[model samples]
Target chain A: MVFTTTKFELLTNKVAASFGLPDARIVTVDHPLGGTDRATIERWADAAVDTVVALLTSG
Target chain B: MADKGELLEIVDASPEAVMDYFDDRGWGDGLPLVPPTVERVEAMLAACGGADPDEVLSVLPPRFGECTRRMVAINAVLAGCRPDVMPVLVTAARALGHPELNLRGVNATTHPVAPLLIVHGDIATSAGYNSGLGAFGPGNRANATTGRAVRFLLLHVAGARPGPGDASTQGQPAKYSYCVAENTAASPWESYPRSVGVDAPSAITLHCGENPHNFHDMEADHPGPILEKAASVMATLGVNNAPIGQGEYFVGLGPEHAATIASHNWTRRDVQSYLYERARLPAGLYRKQFGSLAWFPWMHEVPDDHLMPATGHPDHFKIFVVGGAGKHSCVVPSWGMTKSVTLAVAP
Candidate 1:
């Protein structure tokens, strides 16, 4: 399983496949995390917490 | 090409058709390429001696493509490399796979880092490689094509494209081709390979770094002012070398610059030591900006007022003379996670 952003989605998939995890569980957030304010990042993280938990909990 | 690995032969193997075909499939390096002909590939392979064509050198990351000797020949041909440079190309392939070089990080990082190939010893002149004026610039066929061949290898074998595979935000031009030779003829000291204790007839060094940052000192009769200018370039926080522990700095001195430095009876070690002492900012400034750093043990133990070296060790400041008669030099800063590897040119 992996947590990544939208920009790295394709690269994550490519990396996953190379490491023999073609179907690795990958959760995507927004495109960028750098140069953003803490409040915005925290809000995004808060909104995505439930989905992340569900994905982790799912088989 | 059927998949990423298999380069299938197209029926229309003409020059224009081949270009369009590869361009359409995201295989071209955004430049005109010499079509990989069977005869040309055969010639390139023949220069590699009795090595197995199908032998898998190493599995490159990001795409994990199995790089074979035959594929090396194919890419070399496509890069317009002369058959005489086959052995060097083969060595370059093997060096890229070295664990210490960290090919995986270099391919995936967003630093605009490119694998800089430094050719040394007899190979520079033997194969018509450039080690003189405009060494880092264009016009020399051997230097240009050989460097282009390595980029082609990364593209075809390692599967490193700009966006998907190579995650560089704004990749620099060095990503296209960055190869130069040590100006042994004009250098004051021994050849770079010999100075580094490599006794080989010819060797190649692969360093993943940003483009050269030019520094010039035309009026300096001594080495102090010259090296001080270079130190100023290395001390800035913008470069990766400023914060990282093992980030290497390759200070490329021109002929006249090296002569000026050598006239004061300074050895390579002396130059390194001088740069290590001079290329520093106060430790307190670094601590104020960077929350955490990949610093060497000594950096952490130092006082707040202590001048912290950009790269912790003196040895990390790699000094070698390149370029022709000029008072200019350049600093090639490493990506910090990768290490340079030097290997002999053999099949």
Candidate 2:
């Protein structure tokens, strides 16, 4: 969760490393949520993570 | 009396004194701000994984000052975001600094638009973001804090302190913080990320916007005429982005409305094409009010009567479906000058 004004990739990589996850483990996706609402976005995020975790575990 | 705890003192002092302190220090929002303190700032920093407080995220234009992470923490703390939510704020700050996001030009524009935060993926859920009813209002921590922190950072860090350089005729409510999550459960079409070709997992997108104009069509069960209505509103003149040429537009379709479109086997692009084709305001509507509306210099030879002159490239209309299962839709016009840009949210 470290935020760098510069070097975003490196920062995300650091997080993956801390989690004992490979760089490939880090997934990056564009947000589908509209900017005008919050609950909808949160739900989508929750679903996205669930889907990702399920895929990871199934593999 | 050398330094009798400024935080405690400000809390105990008069509102006038507090405003004076912030104004004197150029920390107020041209209005006023709740005084920020060490305890509050630390709490806010904790939201974003407790990163070092001194990291610089942006050097905003107009004032062109370094928006250090610590300063951002202070503002976020004051804005009342949970510490973990700070990463979202940081990602947003990072996005604003992107050359394409063009916060400098946005801040300077006379348009009544503000940066709108569109959150996606796991972070939105982890932070308890609101994507349901009243999702845009103050009760939601993720929405309130993430958006407000950006506003506070913009003012305190980047220095868009109004009356100095940010001269909007009527600044929007979003100036305080305008962030929301999408309701994917309700959307039948591919989520925004999928439409844009990203498959990773989560991200944050941005749209420079004025207020949203809702389309209430509970009477219509079908998606076509409802979409037509939405598009007509989108193409109307004197609205935020319509006065100018194309850039990007946001269509926030609620669940029932989204289902209608999805049931029709319409992909998000299909819906976008429908809207784009219909976004034609009369040529007469533009010439009188927006004198600057004309063909690009390269098209000087083309006749002026061309319908729907190209305001930007074809990718101008950006669309996504979210919100509860309600009979409603919304169209948020672009700021008419800036384009919507998406930045991946850092974990």
Candidate 3:
């Protein structure tokens, strides 16, 4: 699964398409991952985990 | 006779129409280009010292185009370069291909850094590179076109076109063409190439860098105070150096500034060491600026209470005296994780 920020959504999508990966295999976090506290990072990680799990588990 | 690449019949009524054809095809840097006629390309190829035109110089990314001498000559001709400047362009290309320079990340990343082409030694003067007043600006053909040729190679050959391959959010003016020669005659120390232990009479150093941030100090006559002012600018929290903490930083000192420091009996090594010791951000301040998530594993190696140096070491501060005459100096920060590479210009 791929993870990126909102600002990078266009770039991420383009890169994903280049590698022949559809939108289902990609995930995106917030605009910036810097300057955030550990709890905020954990929250982003938590938000991404379900999508990551589902992508990995799917046939 | 046409070269190996596919020949295109551009049936234009006038020269302007032919230029428009190339522009319409998105092959230009938005500047007027010298028509790369077959003869002009062959003239450029002649300057290559018998190296096979079809010989692969390097494979540039993200498209991983195999750049050959002929391809480079074609771009050089289009960038309006004199045939003599072909060797310098070739050497600069080789430097870009160096593995440690990390051309892959530099070409593809969202960073606003452009490869700064720094020429040193006799070839700098021979090629008419502007190392004096307005060195980084327009007015010199060699400085301008040699750099533009590299950009063209990156765009047409390497496929580092913006939006798709090159993800620069807001690229600087330097992206169009960024090339400068060291004012070796005015400098207190030897040329950068010789100082770095390379015996070549000419060399090119490629650093993935941002636009110059001018550091002014009209008051300081002594080197110590001048360096203190420079250290302040170097330690700015927002720059890539402070946050990333793992690349070289360049300080281009004007002639007057270099003379002032030289009078104090300070060598280039002294200047580098002084800046390294002072240009640091405290660990607490680092965390405040970038937060804990931004910390690299290397940051943990430093004591939590200590101030982390802007670069890996004192040597990472690449200090070179340039510019004709001024009290002003400039600080150039680098793209993180990419090291500057220098290669001797082939005859």
Top TM-score prediction, candidate number: 1
Which portions of model 2 miss their true places by more than 4 Å? A1-59, B1-35, B47-52, B294-306, B309-314
Order of models, best TM-score first: 1, 3, 2
What interface RMSD do all candidates show, one decimal each? 1.0, 15.1, 2.5
Candidate 1 docking classification: medium
For model 2, the docking class works out as incorrect
- Candidate 2, residue B284: Cα displacement in angstroms equals 4.7
Per-residue lDDT over B1-347 for candidate 3, one digit per residue giving the tens place of the 0 to 100 score: 32356567778737688779888988888888877778889999999888888877787776667778888898999899998888888887777788998887887787798999999888898889999998888999999999899999888777777866688878889889999999989989978887777779889889898899898778777998889888898887777767775678889998888899999999999999999899877877777666432345787677657987777678889888778767898989998768888888883
lDDT of 2: 0.68
Give model 3's share of reference contacts: 0.19
Alpha carbon lDDT at A55, candidate 3: 81
**Sort order, DockQ high to low:** 1, 3, 2
lDDT of 2 by residue, B1-347 (tens): 11112344564457688778767776645554555677777676666565655667766765665665666667776676677776777777777888877787787665777888888777778888877676666688788778877777777666565655565667888887888887766667666766676654667778888877788887776778888888777777767565565557888887778887778787777877777677675555566566465344543344446456324444676677666657877888887767676766662
lDDT of 3 by residue, A1-59 (tens): 67778777776666565455655477778767766788998999998898888888888
lDDT of 1 at A32: 78
Residue pairs that clash (backbone atoms under 3 angstroms), model 3: none
Worst 10 residues of 2 chain A by lDDT: A1-10
> Candidate 1: which pairs clash?
none
DockQ metric for all predictions = 0.74, 0.01, 0.32
Measured over all alpha carbons after superposition, the RMSD of each candidate to the real structure, in angstroms, is 2.1, 17.9, 3.3
Q: What is the lDDT of candidate 3?
A: 0.82
